[model samples]
Target: MAACQTEKEEINFPKTDLSNMPMIPKPLKTIPTGSAFGLDAGTAIYTSTTDPAFEKVGRFLSENIKSKTGLELGVNSSSEAKLERLIYINQSDSVDLETPESYQLYIKKDSILLNAKTAAGAFRGIQTLQQLIPTKSNDTLTDHPLWVIPSGKITDAPKYGYRSSMLDVARHFFTVDEVKKYIDALAYYKFNTLHLHLSDDQGWRIEIKSWPKLTEVGGASEVGGGEGGFYTQEEYKDIVAYAADRHITVVPEIDMPGHTNSASLSYPFLHYAGAETPRVRTDMKVGYSSFDAQKDTVYSFLDDVIGEIAAISPGPYFHIGGDESHVTKKSDYILFVEKVEKIVQKHNKRMVGWDEIAQADIDSKSIVQLWNSADNALKAADNGSKLIVSPAKKAYLDMKYDSISEFGLHWAGYIPVDVGYNWDPETYVEGISKENILGIEAPLWSETISNGTELEYLAFPRIIGYAELGWSPSDHLDWEDYKVRLAAQVPYLEAMQINYYPSKLVDWNKE
Candidate 1:
């Protein structure tokens, strides 16, 4: 596919003045049109079959059409009835789809039907439909503002299954509402996974009923000391629910052994010697305090904490952070891995840890989020452990955009938006197969980020690129084309009232 294609050839819609303006330009040929099943201009009816979930999707479509074009869309859930212009969703089709920008829309003149194997697919289709809506004044272009149902077939699926982005809530706390907003934005861009780094030396975000001090005392900190706040169980639940509705899985990370300052402060017994400790420093850095993995009590405590998190999180995976554990005594690290593996199995959830955890004789069921280097990723892949490539040199968004910026931290290399977009995951680890590759994730560490605005400034434009790299086929990604699409997305961000650094304005040559 060429880098660009005209919209008229792809989808037949009345060309309006606004259509030529490039604000809503035609999709690139590489951008698969989910309309593979076929579509017709005639009105279509939709109905649900054995699966009631289809009925919910139908209702959502009806509501969206009503709001966007003031058109009343009819919906029926009966399986026996044959209706023209209709759709059927059965129980057998409830599979998950995690594409970056592909949707499945089935339509015919007599009836139109659409079914997403998963809610994520359904949401992506909705976003595509939104793009089809005319951006110009409805009254000037036509008598009715309703969009013409473009004819075509779309049987689309994502190239990657793990389209994700990681957020560091520990360094700088964001409000529950702000977290929801980020979820909405991620979902809007077709990213399916939201990795929340909930714990670090800086702070512990989630509430633990048994260990109340984890939140009560660890949640808030002194003003100037860089101590931040934490989220209550109620607030965390609310955020999870909100993400669920948007078809985005919330993967919570509780860094262990190393990033356990907050955990130690809350439950002194979790420390190496079971010595009581007060609230720790807010500086975002590697933690020295670690749980005594050799101790049985430590595993019990982890089981309890994981149990609390699992109860609230509906996702199938749990992140038992095993990264940067400098305090791990050689024997203790091995025992810790053994115990953690058992606990992960007990919970019936796959364990995900940083690449460093691979050294602890962990099970293959564990998924490794490779950060330090490709060597770790290769080792994990060789051991049959799935890996999410997030090498710090290329995928870490927390690094300053340039070396000149005095963002407080100097250790992490400066990386700009272009540098992030230029990173190709397939090439990151030489021998790793794409099948073994789970997906790509951009980690926004919060050493210098103090608040939500700073977080947005660093995450936005770069995140969009990562989303594309994770979603689109590697051969199809074009930096120039992405910049075009990214330019169009800026206004949407503005309308949404987000503070993100503009990629176009950032002078990559300055360094």
Candidate 2:
């Protein structure tokens, strides 16, 4: 039997309308053509240029298509002739796009064209295209004769350049493969940044070669007193490379002053004199342990740590966890932050810290992440530092869906799916406007969750809406319309086997 019908053959496509297709973080503009594109074995993916960037995305599209529909679509880079039933990926020569991640997608009965100014843009466009593929035909094991994509034209770009998700690996170390899986989920939602909370009171998840004891002693235990783990330098690089291939930047964070029990346990010198000698902590309590802010050696130690991590990390920013220094005096805390800022600058990376860092005289190029304090956020804006808003009530993933939910905390109160999506970052704090904002980040602190399933349960559904909040324009967001779009994502999530919360607020679709 023939795998696909020829151009001369008559193949009737099902009537399709994409006017209200469930696309998270809806595109800036969409026009449904009331037609559809049918995929078969004969379709080929074509790259318009020889650039590896375009080729990479082309191959990615082909691979994803094959995985979903049991179709063998070959990627052709040398093709110059127009081809029927082809997916053409191109890098446009335009400098006027809103951001480097901007893209345009046009789909017709015979072909799909994707145009972007950069590879990141092409990657995002492909994600939107993936959403257009009907879930009924998305089976890899079974031989599916046909797959369909709704015909449409979409022009899209993110409202914020830094749509990020933070994974806290310090409290409970997640393996590289586990982290990569998290990265895949982030990329599928068009998130561009993965902020790794690498160190905290419970554990240290990255190896420091100069100070072997840091990981040897500090990384040995986790929140439940279980034998924890750490990633070697080579392993860290591999994770970074994997994320880069998906167009996501890896932002490494090492919390300091406070959240230093794991570090101080490895070296006694880090603790203040006459203070209780820090021991390994498995409990969830915070703001107890702190680095010796009065010591010059503490600054010298940070120089080596920052230099080593920055050398391997290619990203432009370094996050120093500057929150929760309850034990340290306010004056000393401010001085510690100021000195650490210089050390971070010396490593050629812009400094990033929690909102408390605003108390220090830091550089304007630095970024302040707002987690619990709006006053600190306002202070950061006053100091001219950019802010990444992750308000606890709205963006904290570890917050339980409700009192009955399993595997999450309730200190920040229950953050149901709707609550996570209904807030605005630009005006969340009065003094912090659009100009002083970098973007929004949903931080998944791993205090309660231990494995991938638990992580997915807490992150999905809500994270999907967070992605929309970060990408879609503020004026265009409507809760009623978005819940429907989010409900449409049920099939994709089910197909991917993501263990998402079945929130009662959304009337999810059945597969």
Candidate 3:
């Protein structure tokens, strides 16, 4: 055990003025060495009297240090009055030391304490620390680089609690390793939520113990194009663990009440009786096969499926996809809502559905992901449901960033990087208050994206812009400033060999 220091030391840094920016703080004089890894490798020392949330921070540091530094770390909590090399989270204080929504990192000699008023802030602080830790390439710096902690403190919290990015693994399945890489990328950008569209008309991407055919048969494809396979239960679990380690929640979406072609193909009864056995539709557009939401068997089957998925995902929300259920009889929509509500309540989980699902007489607790228009978000909020704004006109990343017709699906107008960066959700809905907005999401529907590289190409640059929109205050995000920051991020992405869409060349000097 390391001896604890018992004195308060006044800390000071050079007050040299650099950029006159009010927000940017002067760099700290000293930098802390060593790294904290995954959850199990503890770092922070606290008293048993420490808040549970503070303990959570310690667990996070331990886990993070092991994963990032490949070193095991331990935490010791004490009531002794001392100043040490580590950060000390003073839970006794009511004022928040760091922003709850964005990332923060603090460093001190011998010990460091990552403190946040809220659990989310603690999580974000750890994320920033992960970014600060030197990777293999950064280990050989010429000057002993100081871990300059950003000053002027941010009382930061998320603009939207549900800043999400949805990945369509059903269109073209990504391997577990590829999925883990994607999770890492999302974490880097401060996107806390990852929606895995695991099942669709094309294929079922998870194994079901009760229904082996769902994976054994539906996971395979007869059509050679867009033909990829499902992940085994073990692989899916590993992916979940990986995302958990990154503090990113994985919300598995099983398209139902529609988009059940794959599941229907596995079991004929899942669809309307005597309907033709569903097959993979090669057309990129959404297909119509849906589970008979009115059937008792349908509810039973879904309960089993959702139970399996919920067991693996630690997220509090589940996506019971209710989009484009063309075959859902008017009566079935009502019944579908009832059945979904029962399942969600039974599992102690919240449900999230596309805007159309709002039509069903569902509980207000279900989150509405407004995709078609801002009006949908307004309506959802008015109806007392939380909202995630992902309007097709502005936030949809699947749309091409340029006028190149060859790029995007082309239903909505092409939206380039600047267009994405320029979108203001606060202004999109005229009378609705921003308080109703739970957060923003940029969906990457994989109808056209067939491989990891294509997925990367379409996702980045645009995704970065979305992250800023989600994290930074709306007034703080400027197109010119964002472009500058974005340019710096390109080399980092390249160093990681990330495939991404190139931003259109712009002459910023003229502006």
User: Using TM-score as the measure, which candidate wins?
Assistant: 2
Against the true structure, candidate 3 reaches a TM-score of: 0.79
Best candidate (score: lDDT): 2
Query: Where is model 1 more than 4 Å wrong at Cα?
Result: 1-49, 59-103, 106-115, 146-155, 222-227, 273-279, 403-410, 505-511
User: 2 or 3, which is superior by TM-score?
Assistant: 2
lDDT of 3 by residue, 18-62 (tens): 122212111112233333221112234442235666566666666
Looking at model 2, report the run of 10 residues with the lowest lDDT sum. Answer: 1-10
lDDT of 2 at 498: 88
RMSD of 2: 3.0
Candidate 3, residue 165: CA error in Å? 0.5
lDDT of each: 0.67, 0.87, 0.67
User: By lDDT, highest first, what's the ranking?
Assistant: 2, 3, 1
Residues 28-144 of candidate 1 have per-residue lDDT tens digits of 222222221112222233544555555665676666556555656566634423222344432224343333334455443233344565545566666555544433333322333
Cα lDDT tens digits for candidate 2, 293-320:
8998888888989999999999999999
Please say which candidate is ahead in TM-score: 1 or 3.
1
- Candidate 3: list runs displaced more than 4 Å: 1-93, 97-113, 129-155, 222-226, 273-277, 373-375, 405-407, 505-511
